[model samples]
Target: MNPTRHAVSLGLRRGWTEFVLSLRSPQDQGFYLFMGVGTLAYLWFNRDTELEGTGLLLPTFALPSILGALIAFGVVIGPAYALAMEREDGTLLRHKALPHGMQGYVTGQLLYHSLGLLPLLLVILVPSFLLFDDVMSNGAAGWATVAWVLVLGLLATLPLGMIIGSVVPSVQKVGTWGMLPIITLSAISGIFFPIQAMWGWLQAVAQVFPIYWIGLGMRSAFLPDAAVTVELGDSWRTGTTVLVLAAWAVFGMLVTPRVLRRMARRQSGSQVQQAKEAALQWVR
Candidate 1:
């Protein structure tokens, strides 16, 4: 087998193994439960409320947008934290010593994080259908849209996480460098409210990021045609969503490897030791 392919295969296996382990881990289980329960509770409380004009139930409008936000949040923050912690613990350095190891390592990270979405989605989506009516309006076509949007959203957002991880000085910094920015984006991206309600410039800023497009794409999938009136331009802008997400995916493909390689090159025993010492001190 070609060396890169072999490395990729190994990476895929490693990712799968990690994901399986996470499923069994109590900590991960708690996280899944918390997110699922929290989201369901929010939707449930708002179940009876209707959108001011559309007469659509709040849950019907919110579920898909929440899904999109979660996708962007999970992919981006999960990888960022993983990469940062692994870097501090010498994982990156260990991988750097092997032939085509980085490739495998990256492959593993991508697969692990991507698979992580399933349980999260299932936790929310399964109950959502039971708790809310018309959560999925378009049926088969809606599901098809979901499939494509999810693929594109992952491509677009996962790399940003990796890049943030590769660049942040330490795992602790991920909150400021990665999490805060994404949270800010989510607030402006129409996850909780309509984007059209924001100022014109803020709307433009929100549209520039993948989170907004991801949420928009998701809403397009789960929402009926009439829901478009609540969206910007009073349209789902399906073509624009596709183009924007694809653009981000392309950017990530072109940029993430270079950023990772540069970060990897800088890793050394001394740096790892320093990080460990710093962590110990912080813990103290």
Candidate 2:
């Protein structure tokens, strides 16, 4: 096998192990659950406005999209930060020096987080059904939308998380800064209100990233055809979003090796020590 493929396979196996760890990992899981709940509650409170008087309709559309955005980012960001910290600590160097080390390192994170959001999605989904059973059942299309968003959200967030984590200083900053894009993008993506309210120039900025398109994809999935609001108008919005995200994924794949190489080449012993001490204090 090619060294890259071999490394990815090993990383995937290790990442799978870590995925199980994430299941048992409290802080990581909490990171996801907290936002999932917060999003659900926030949307529930404003259900009427977003839903336009359809209270029961909120969960079907709202919960999954929010949870997908929240949890998917959570899943990727934490592990990436952890990996970076390890890199800072010189563990990544040790691993990287190993045959296929870099590949394994990245693959472990990707695979571990891939299906990691499933349980959390279920957690968000079931209660949503309990509370908004009528609305959810009413729109079969909505359910389909929810499922699709969750899937695409996974695809979008996982690689993006890898990109973010590759350079982030530590896990602490990951929580602080990493979550910002997802949250900010969610707003831009039309999750909070409508991105349509913004000027075209700003709207153009929002769409520069995948958040708006992903949110639009989610919007299409969850709301009925009539209730659905696709603020950013692209005739082939879904296909476009998929293409954009896939392009990013490819970009991430291509750039990650170079980024890793650059990060490795630039890192020195003292800086790493200083980084670890700072990380420990911050974590504590």
Candidate 3:
């Protein structure tokens, strides 16, 4: 087998093993449960409320957007945390010692983070259908849209996480460098309300990021044609969503490897030891 392919295969297996382990871990289980329950509770409480003039139930409008935000949040933050922690613990250095190891490590990360999303999605989506009416208006077509939007969203956002992880000064900095930014984006990205309600420049800033397009693509999937009136330009802008997400994906693909390489080149035993000592001091 080609060396890179063999490395990737190993990475895939490694990722699967990690995912299986995560499923059995109490901490991960608790997180999944918390997110599922919290989201469902929010939707349930708002079940009777309608979106002002749209005549759509709040849950019906909110669910897809929430899912989109989750996708964006999960893929980006999850990898960022993983990479940062692993870097601090010498995992990246260990991988650097092997032939084509970085490739395998990256492959593992991509797969692990991508698969981790399933439990969260199932937790939210399954019960959501059981509890909500008109949850999915377009049926098969809607589902197909869901599939593509998820794929593109993953491609667009996951690299940002990796890049962030590769660049942050330390694992502790991820909050300021990664989490805060994502939270801010979610606020402006129409996950909670219509984007049109925001000031014009805020709307433009929001549209520049993948979170907005991901939410929009998701809304387009589950929402009926009439829901477009509540969206920017009064259309789903499916083409624009794809174009924007693909552009991000391309940018990530071109940039992430270079960033990772630079970060990798700087890793050393002394740096790792210094990180450990810093962590110990912080813990103290």
Candidate 4:
């Protein structure tokens, strides 16, 4: 096999390994449980509640939106934290020494993080089916819509995470630079509420980002046709969602490689040492 292909294959295997390890790790399992339970609890409590204008129950409306938020959150923060930590721990430096190692490393990050989303969706989605009715309104077509939207959303947002991770000074900084903004965006992107409830300018701003569109697409997938009454413009705007996500994916595809290349080029023993010292200081 070609050397680069060999590296990518190893990376894919590494990703799968990491995912399996994460599943076995007590801390990670706890996190998954907490998220799944918390989400299900929230939705369960609101199971009987109805949307004001649409007459649809809140859980059915919120489930897909929450799924989108989880996807956006996972793909972004996962890579950011991973890159920053690995950079400090000399993982990137080690990769930098090899032929096409960065390629392999990036492939691993994408695979691991993307696969990481499965348990998150499954834990909630499975219970949701048992607890709620008509949760999937558009039937087969909606599932197809979900597949595309998820692909586009991941393509759109994962690169941003890589970009942020490449630039951030430390893993600690990811909280400030990555987590805060993403969490804030989730709030405004209508994961828990309607975008139409926000100010017009804020709505416009939210629309510019993929999170909003992802949530919108998820809603379109899960909600009945009548639920469109609550969405902005009273439509799913599927075409616009695809366009915006595609644009981000394109931008990321063009820019992330350059950024990663720059970052990789700068990796050296001294920088990795400094990063380690800084991390130790943080621990102290």
TM-score of 2: 0.79
Identify the runs in model 1 with alpha carbons over 4 angstroms from their true place. none
lDDT of 4 by residue, 38-95 (tens): 9999999999998897788999899999999999999999999999889888999998
Task: Compose the digit string of candidate 3's lDDT tens values, residues 192-241.
Answer: 99988899999999999999999999999999999899997798999999
User: Best lDDT goes to which candidate?
Assistant: 3
Runs in model 2 deviating more than 4 A are 1-6, 47-50, 53-61, 134-155, 169-177, 233-236, 267-271, 280-284
C-alpha-based local distance difference test score of model 1: 0.96
Clashing pairs in 2: 11-108, 15-108, 145-221
In model 1, pairs of residues that clash are: none
Clashing residue pairs found in predicted model 4: none
lDDT of each: 0.96, 0.65, 0.96, 0.92
Candidate 2 at 132: error in angstroms?
0.9
Deviation in Å, model 2, residue 251 alpha carbon: 2.4
> Per-residue lDDT for 209-244 in model 2, tens only?
766666666666555555543344424267777787
* Each candidate: RMSD: 0.7, 3.6, 0.7, 1.1
Candidate 2 or 4, higher TM-score? 4
Worst 10 residues of 1 by lDDT: 127-136
Q: List candidate 4 segments past 4 Å from native.
A: none
